[model samples]
Structure formats: C-alpha cells, structure tokens
Target: MGTWQLVLVGLVMLLGLLGVLVPGVPGPLLVWAGILWWSMSEKTTPAWGVLIGATALLLVNHVVKWLLPARRLKGVGVTRQTVLWAGASAIVGFFVVPLIGAVLGFIAGIYGAERVRLGGHGEAWAATRTIMRAVGTSVLVELVACLLVLGAWMGAVIHG
Candidate 1:
C-alpha cells in the first residue's frame, strides 16, 4: 500500500477500536474491512496471510465474547430475561441518550432486572457488578484482538 493508503488504513483501524466501545458500530467488521483494504491494496502473500489470520482470530473473538459472559451469567443464576432486558435497554439508550447512554442503560437495565427479581438493592447491585465485569472483560478481549490486528497491519505496511 502507498503511504496515503496506509494512513487511511490506520485511521480505519482507529475507528474500529472506537467501535468496540460505541454501541451500533460493528468493531470487528470494521477491523476486518481495514485488513481487506490493506491486503487488496498491497496484494502480497504476507499481507494476505495476515488478513486470513486476523479474520480467524476475529471470528474466535466473536464466539468467545458471546459464550464466555453468557456461561458466567448462567452459572451465577442470572436469567436470560435479565440479559434480554439489558439488550432492550441498550437499544433504547442508543436512541435516547446517544453513545454513552447505551452503556448506562445496559447497566441500569441489568440492575433493574435484578432488583425486580431479587427484591433488594444489595443483591441487584451485586448482579449488576457481575454483569458489568463480564461485559468489560468481553470488551477488553475485543479491544486486544483489534489491537493485534492493527499491529499486524502496521507490520505488513512496514515490511511488505
């Protein structure tokens, strides 16, 4: 890739990273698109190989993000209804309050669900903390995976 193309790819990767934190933005898809953009422009074996590897890693990240937290929640007695409420709240929050609202709404939703189900603020807060931690862990995993992909792309740009 040319200098300008590399710069563009870097910018895309940055946006991909931001998308991980922002609701409604497809972070992994954006990262994969960045890889595709770079590989298509470079057309080198190493670039293509990196692209394939990143794709595989991203796929695994997606599966793990969903399964790990879900398993943890289920193991801790969190019901699917709570998760659904949180998801629905996130959607509403995305429209009502913008970028940060989704996260806030998700937290509130989980807390609310637990409060209703368990009938105490202490227990509800505990559940909220658990859910938040799981979510944070999932986001961290995605961020790390994205950073690795960005690093690989930078390496390819430098060494291709």
Candidate 2:
C-alpha cells in the first residue's frame, strides 16, 4: 500500500477504536475491514499474517463478548461521556505503560469521571464499580482486541 493508503488504513482503525465506545457502531468490524483492505492492497506475507490474526482475534472478541453479561449501562446510569473518557485514557495508558496500562487507565478514567460527576470519593467509587460491572468488561475486551490488531498492523507496516 502507498503511504496515503496506509494512513487511511490507520485512520479507519482509529475510528474503529473510537467506535468501541460508541453504542451500535460495529467497531471490530471496521478494524477488521481496514486490515482486509491493507492486506488485499499490499499482498505481502506480513500483511496476510496481520489480517489473519486480526480476523481470529476479532472473532474471539465476539465470542467472549457474547459470553459476558449483557450491558446494563442504562440501568446503572453510566453516561457516554464516561465511556469516552475511559477510552481516551486507555489509549494514553496503552502508550504510557504498555499493555497493562490500558486496563488501569480505563478504570481510572471511570473513577475520575464518576468522581467529578458525583462529587464524592465514596459515591464515585461505588458508581465506578457499578458501571464496570454493567458494561466495562465488554468494552474493555473489544478495545483490547482492536488495539492488538492495530499494533499488529503497525508492526507489519513498519517492518514488512
């Protein structure tokens, strides 16, 4: 793929990552499609490998998400702003502290957002816990899977 095509692929993947936080956005599908596009255009061994890995990973993500409890954010009163904060924090955390940072950042982001919204440490923590139980795991799983795919694509692009 040309540089511009690669950049576009990256943008698609970025949108996919954002889609994970947005309801009914088909995040993983976008990520997978970006990989498919790149692989089809590049036709290189590494591109093919990344595409296969992304496919398998995203398939597993779907299965894992299905096994998890259904999202109850509406009942729990979790807001989209909170999710967006958590997602942005996760991205920063991924770069700041590598793989584990994403989870830590997500939790912290929830807590911080809740703290600001509820205006009490105890209430915020409680809300954070409730929100996590309601929908955090599902979002986290999808985000991590997408991030892994993005990382793999980046590796292939840089080293292929």
Candidate 3:
C-alpha cells in the first residue's frame, strides 16, 4: 500500500475503534473492512495473515457479544454520557497503563460519572454495578477485540 493508503486505512481503523463505544455502530465490521482493504492493496504474506487473524478474531468477538447479556441501560438509568466517559477513560488507560488499565479505567469512569450524577458513593457504586452487569462486558469484549486487531495490523505494517 502507498503511504496515503496506509494512512487512510489507519484512519478507518481509528474511527472503528471510536465506533465501538457508540451504540448502534458496526464497529467490528468497520475495523475488519479496513484490514481487508489494506490486505488487498498490500497483497503480502503478513498482510494476508493479519486479515485472516482479524476476521477470525472479530467473528469470535461477535459470538461472544451475542452470548453476553444484552445492554439495558435505560432500566439501569445509565446515560450515554456516562458510557462516553468510560470509553474515553478506557482509551487513555490503554495507553497509560497498558492492557489492565483499560478495565480499571472503565470501572473508575463509571463510578466517577455515577458519583457525580447520584451524589453519593454508595448509590454510585450500586449503579455502577448495575451498569456493568447490564452492558459493560459486551462493550469491553468488543473494544478489546478491535484493539487487538488494530495492534496486529500496526505490527504487520511496521514489520512488512
């Protein structure tokens, strides 16, 4: 792929990463499509390998997401803003403390948002738990899967 094409692919992947946070967005599919586009353009062994791995990984991600409990944010009263905060925090955490930090940051972000909204630690914690049980696992799984795919693509691009 040319430099511009690579940059465009990277931009698409980044958008897909952000899409994972927003409800109703086909984040995984977008990420996979970006990989496919890059692989087709590059036509190298590593590029093809990355595409295959990303496809399998994202397919598993979809299955796992389906198996998880459906999101019930309305029942739990978790707002979209809270989810956005959690996602933004997760991104920062991923870079700040690596893999584990993402989880910690997500949980903290939820707690912080709930604390601000509910005005008490106890209530916020309860709401946080409810929110997590309702939707956190699904989002976390999808985010991690996309991150893995993005990381693999970056590695291939760098090494190829």
Which candidate has the highest TM-score of all? 1
lDDT tens digits by residue: candidate 3, 6-104: 999999999999889865468999899999999999898899999999999999999888666434667677888888898888778777986577777
Task: Report how far off residue 136 is in candidate 3 (Å).
Answer: 1.2
Q: Assess each prediction's global lDDT (C-alpha) against the native.
A: 0.89, 0.85, 0.87
Q: What is the per-residue lDDT of model 2 for residues 38-97, given as tens digits with 9 covering 90 to 100?
A: 999999888889988899999999988866634566666778898889888877887898
| Model 3 clash number | 0
Judged by TM-score relative to the true structure, which candidate is superior, 1 or 2?
Answer: 1
State residue 71's C-alpha deviation in candidate 3, in Å. Answer: 12
The deviation in Å at residue 37 for candidate 1 is: 1.0
Candidate achieving higher TM-score, 2 or 3: 3
Model 1 lowest lDDT segment of ten: 151-160
How would you encode candidate 1's per-residue C-alpha lDDT over 47-136 as one tens digit per residue? 899999999999999999898788878877999899999999988987899668898889989999999999999999999999888889
Q: Given candidate 2, what's the lDDT at residue 38?
A: 96
